[model samples]
Target: MSGRVSHTVDMSVKLGELTLRTPVLTASGTFASGREFADFIDLERLGAVVTKGVSLEPWEGSPSPRIAETPSGMLNSIGLQNPGVEAFCEDDLAWLSSVDVPVIVNVSGHTVLEYVSVIERLEVEPRVDAYEINISCPNVDSGGMAFGTACTPAEEVTRACRAATSRPLIVKLSPNVTDIAEIARAVVASGADGVSLINTLLGMAIDIRTFRPKLARIVGGLSGPAIKPVALRMVWQVAGAVDVPVIGMGGITDTEDAVEFMLAGATAISVGTANFVDPTTVMRVTDGLAEFCRTRSIARVSNLTGAMRT
Candidate 1:
């Protein structure tokens, strides 16, 4: 027999006051509250289930042909379509309450008041363990600028949500900004417990045959492996800039991708676009992480956070 010593690796991680069983979480908009993917994998196996963006009122969303495939990536402009917070509580939150895993609702709105309203509505629900403020939604009152793109608006929205609930607050930052770190700092200063980043880069595609734009909106949010490099860079920057935990997500598909993010200073990582390619990707990555740590005799997976060598 080989002289390899067995080791038990601890996968639990802490984000503010919240403790996650593992670092692997389901990115919002991809998992859809976890009920849809329950048949393929056990929901309890994930660190957390971040639900799709929910607003104060129902959003009609963008027109059809809002999706397009590109090299190593895909573009989408779904517009955060949802049945509003009240319906979400009646349906998604009700179902999630039965699951053992933590639920982090992705709150969206066109104004600061709308953001607070969504959190206030969800505050009554016992199922919600945390809140991931999706500031990627356009600020209609601010001339359509995404709340996550600017420091002032980002802080304004985050502060309002912070006052609305005492739950763990994590703001999802947009990559379509001049300096993502500045926006992250702004949100944290306003009272965000943690931050999740690289929410798809703005991109577009055109159909040569039809001589038209592939997506109906002319441009859409790009996700998948194409953005992994950019995502890693931003995670490194924001993680260093902020004292709070950083949830890195962009094109993570496997165990190595998750490891890379952790090394880049992410306290946790989220699986997004790859969920479409493999329904069991999150579980596979979660299990793989344990095996990876055991092989390295790391003892605990938390040691991998920001362990990168420059």
Candidate 2:
């Protein structure tokens, strides 16, 4: 009886040799901590579910005031908070694999060796279907050596990890750079199968009343609708520059925005900060795409990728 009303669109999308059900995916950090979201959102319906970045060691995250709301977005210095790789393998992966979705595990490290160490461990595990290397973490030890923003460091780490891991590598880029296209091309040259764009723009918000920074970290990465225009523009620019697949994300709060990215040449779209406001956002976005196709008599969502023009 319910099947009559249920309309499932062909959400299949391919990343290199990998295929996804829906082009709509969840971003790394914006994900809910538990597996309970499956019932409400239908994880299987998503193109992919990217877990929060996992590190070689457990992270307590930045001190209090880790997040703040900006004019159109929010700033976060949550500091890549995640259980260590070993802990994730035991506590998270078992349940993550239990889900019907394809899980792309985001791996983070401070140095080339750190990146290699993490992926080497993951290579043996079946829990993660792919890897997204996060090279943008603001460094405290090196006085802030952001890997993705710097072309040299970005290429080095990307090459190191790409060589270490067997899974499809998606190099997540930093929007803090002066030239996003340059870095995107660098990663692809270093052997990345694909690239994920515009990882949080670095920003700060001041508290007028308190006469201090809005967040405890003093600064944070901005996400949400505020960065939508910039993200879309960068996605389009980077898409033109790089030959590999581009996973477009940022300020994607709805399906229309996802379509905008697809037209802009994004092979797939990801939902970031929206998850905090709506836990069922993934399903809503995927369902919205399906409806968009049905109304237009479109047969598959794949045809929508890169359908945009200048």
Candidate 3:
């Protein structure tokens, strides 16, 4: 047997100026408020927990048949369902605050005022470590254009959200745009602390027998291993263009996939759809990351960011 030193590898990472103990984190909406996977994995083992989209008021969500399975991915149009901010703070935050990990609240809205209102309400809460502005939601104020699809609206929304809170603000960008790098630059200039990208590609599916769309919404956000290449391409481009830390995500299911994103320039990664396949995914990723570092003799995991060669 070969003797390899059983040395400890450093896994801490920084998203902008926010230091995370590990680079592994759960994607918003997929992880909920940490209650769902508490029995399967320890919450503190991961870097952070990104809670589901929280709006100013309750959301009933979309109609039935909201999910459809594709060849290697899935489509979902859940419509940002969540209990209002008040209820979230009373129930979700109360429990999350007791946990050891940092909490990143994902805030969504149909209008600028709505987004600002939610931030104002949560700004003073000590349990909230950071805010992830969800600009992918359709803007009711802009005739249904997604704020993340345009640089102007993206900048406007980011500016409003940034002004409302002092905590580190991360803008989640939509892939359905002409130039993602331009949008990333716009938001960053408007005071975004960091950026997370390739939030599901817009896609759809139809049932051959029924002659109807698989999902009630007809079109939905597509996610899984199938989109890995697109996600990686976008992450690499944005990481090269932007100065702030980039949180890369979209179709990450294992440790190798996580490492690819880091090498592409992601300071951290959020595991999405995979959480549904395995509740213990976060625990496995965090441990597996350390193993990869140990085996490869990597002194610190942070060194992997932007290590890609030309």
**Ranking of all candidate structures by their TM-score, best first:** 1, 3, 2
lDDT for model 1, on a 0 to 1 scale? 0.89
**Residue 130 lDDT in candidate 1:** 94
Q: Could you tell me every candidate's TM-score relative to the true structure?
A: 0.96, 0.94, 0.95
How does residue 180 of candidate 1 score in lDDT?
Answer: 92
Alpha carbon lDDT of each predicted model = 0.89, 0.82, 0.87
lDDT for model 2, please: 0.82
Q: What are the per-residue Cα lDDT tens digits for candidate 2 across 1-310?
A: 1232125456688999789877888888888434857656667667888888887878787887888988878888888777888988887788886777788888888778877888988888887899988876552233123788788888999899888876899999888888999999988999999999778888888999989998887878889999999999999999999998899999998889988998898989999998888887877777777777777777877778778755
Worst 10 residues of 1 by lDDT: 136-145
Candidate 3 TM-score to native: 0.95
Worst 10 residues of 3 by lDDT: 136-145
Better of 2 and 3 by lDDT: 3
